[model samples]
Target: MALTDLYDRASSLLERRFLKNAFLPVAVFPVILSWPILIQSGRLDRLAAWWESLSTAGRIVLGLAYFVVTWFFAAIVASQWRNIIRLFEGYPIERTPLGQRSADWHRRRRTEATQWQHYLEYPDEDEVLPTRLGNILRTAERYPFARYNADTIVIWPRLYHLLPESVQRDVEDRRATLEFLLVTCLFWAAFGVADFIILSVTGAAPWVACLCLLVGAVGATLAYESSLSAAMEYGERIKAGFELHRGQLLAALGLKTPGSLEEEKRMWRAFDKFVRQARPADMEQYRRTSAPPTGGA
Candidate 1:
């Protein structure tokens, strides 16, 4: 089944309740960030002694860090909530309407053109299909509920939450895989930041902080690369499904099945790039390209 069908099968109750109450958490997020203030407000008599033990500057620093951390989290939640709303509202995963070009069409074409050329030059279908699919699947995971958007991390959870139970397992697995990579990236980045701050404050060796930063960057990069690899794995897993409905998939997109894997690769490269670039008015032109030319009457 196409992704559209899975979206249709999502739980209405979950969608309604989640969307209705999502704002509540975001609205109250400030309270969580204000724990230090709450302590000073005499709300926690038991911890008053402990709170008082901290120097004024220490308290201020801790409070500010808390505020920064929690606010950052709140922003992420709010962004994700917006994604959920868009999903429930029936946004297309790929925003470029069939045949209509997007603003970034040329840049997108330039990137995919390289991949298309690689596929054409290589005769390894088994390897190429996964590589191509992986890229596509990864991209899809990053931009759930929209064809184009900047909110590109941890999107699998939101998308998974929308799937019907029957389809949830597969999506959940994908989510888990992607989430692990994302969390790994965050973990390294956070540790590096924390280490840098601690080292700077203590006047400890600056080299240690620099080393921590480098390690964190490397970890994040590895995680990112792993995500792309995993995405390719995901694509391979779904390629059979795509093949099952190949005709429908191609027909809907104004594409034709290539006579050979090489041709298929070329067609897919064009199709992928074109879908991102084509304007609505160009839809007829695309259709005619794939259609048999009529004989002269």
Candidate 2:
């Protein structure tokens, strides 16, 4: 299959499977991670006995829950690992249809709106300070495909891989932080499931089960929110590091970022329109037509 087709299919599959209900998948980890403990403590036998003793209705409910959890685990693990394998094997990270809606809406507004500069890098005198952190987060949230070290790596793999070790390390660290948070959240959720199973097997009151579920829900939310806040704080430094090497980054993508004020202004104007108007399928074409060539690092 073509690179774009592969990218779209991979991206759509990932977003559809994982992004929609990230927290729900956390339910799967309890069974997977607790297996060793269960076996070692002979709790696996006890758990089996408890399951076998349950009423037919209870068995059906528990079976359905486990099925959902296992399916989520299988789907998330397969989709993410496949994407990682594909990307490392030199595949492009193309934009998905969902990712393009924001740009398309912006493009529509640009047609009716007179203030085109608002969309560009240059901010008006009265505008809020467009801090580097704000810009990076906004872009990442609105246009994941446009972020640093994404599809550009596919276009200039040699140059991207040759970037300063420290710069590359910083980028990797940012990615690691996100991955750590995701795993942490998933594990926490799984632990909650374990708690529920233990409580139920030990003949806890129904009200106790309800309380545990509530606490688990709160814990998961807190974990997600806290990690997101921390990541955002660290993302600022990552953004700055990328900005410091903006020239090299653009060069790696075969784009010549403007050095002069006049050139910079012109480039921003063109980029604003390019990002706003280009369709997901037309992204490569836009870059080829608009981005001036740059000397490699």
Candidate 3:
């Protein structure tokens, strides 16, 4: 397989997974800080009772301190959780078919697509192999047999759609991956919240609970990165599959592998139009069904 194909596969699979993995810590950091204070809650309650037995001025001072503490926690959780929820609920991109009509899934897809777009758009000279695979994919879309990567330049005489259905299925399977990730993220968020409650009720300080959650979020990122690196194996495999049979995809788009540059550029313009116009409905569907389940960490 060519380097361009390899990059495409890796780009699509890894970027969203990486971001979903990063979101947890942002949600849990405050909770971790509150633990130290929460640990003193019991003793503080006793102290407050004692103060209540003293003069009214003493009780008033204690009440004011409690208000400050509660307000601080509320402010922290409010601001942090909003960002966490937005990450989970992906805002703007959730409005398109490109996003699977689900925020989590949409953000995952949009991020991957945009990341790949960015990666391919740039060139790397310091690496073992310099790359412009993104442009190559576009070039190939317009001019099928055009081989830009040093590793591979072999192209067959074919259109994309003529390839077997199996290849099409492979490309579409990404949607399933999104679904899996969306559900998994929601589950983990809920688990984190539950763990927080369980530990907090046991007299763990709020900060301690927050720390535990932060650790959990970090663990999730590590696991996702590990899994994604493994999953990237698909990138290599699919590239091979596409090249072995490039006809199907090209035909589906009514594209010849090496179509004219002008035609390829124009087609992309059309694609943009379709994406912009139809995305609102897609976004609406996702908001209804794909918003993270109620009550996440």
Candidate lDDT scores, in order, read 0.46, 0.49, 0.42
Q: List the residue pairs that clash in candidate 2.
A: none
Rank list by lDDT: 2, 1, 3
Q: What tens-digit string does per-residue lDDT give for candidate 3 at 1-297?
A: 577976786676544433333333334444544444445455556655776688878778866876566556545543443344334333333445543333343234334465464333222211211112222232223222223221222222232234444564554354335333433444445556766776788776678678667765765555444333333333433455545554343334343333555554444344334354653432231122233232210
| lDDT measured at residue 270 in model 3 versus the true structure, 0 to 100 | 42
- Worst lDDT 10-window in candidate 2: 121-130
Q: Of the candidates shown, which would achieve the greatest lDDT relative to the real structure?
A: 2
The clash tally of candidate 2 reads 0
Question: Candidate 2, 24: how far from true, in Å?
Answer: 18
Give the TM-score comparing model 1 with the true structure, all chains together. 0.36
* Model 2: CA > 4 A from native: 1-28, 31-78, 81-136, 139-162, 190-203, 250-259, 268-297
Which wins on lDDT, candidate 1 or candidate 2? 2
Model 2 lDDT tens row, 1-297: 477965785576555545433434455455644664465446899999998899999989987998777676756664574343233212232244533443444445445655433333212222212232222234333221234323222223333355565665565555545544545555566566766676667666666555655666676666666655544645554445544555664555444555565553444344444455663442333243454544543
Each candidate structure's TM-score, on Cα atoms with residue i matched to residue i, is 0.36, 0.41, 0.32
10 residues in a row with least lDDT, candidate 1: 121-130
Give the local distance difference test score of model 3: 0.42
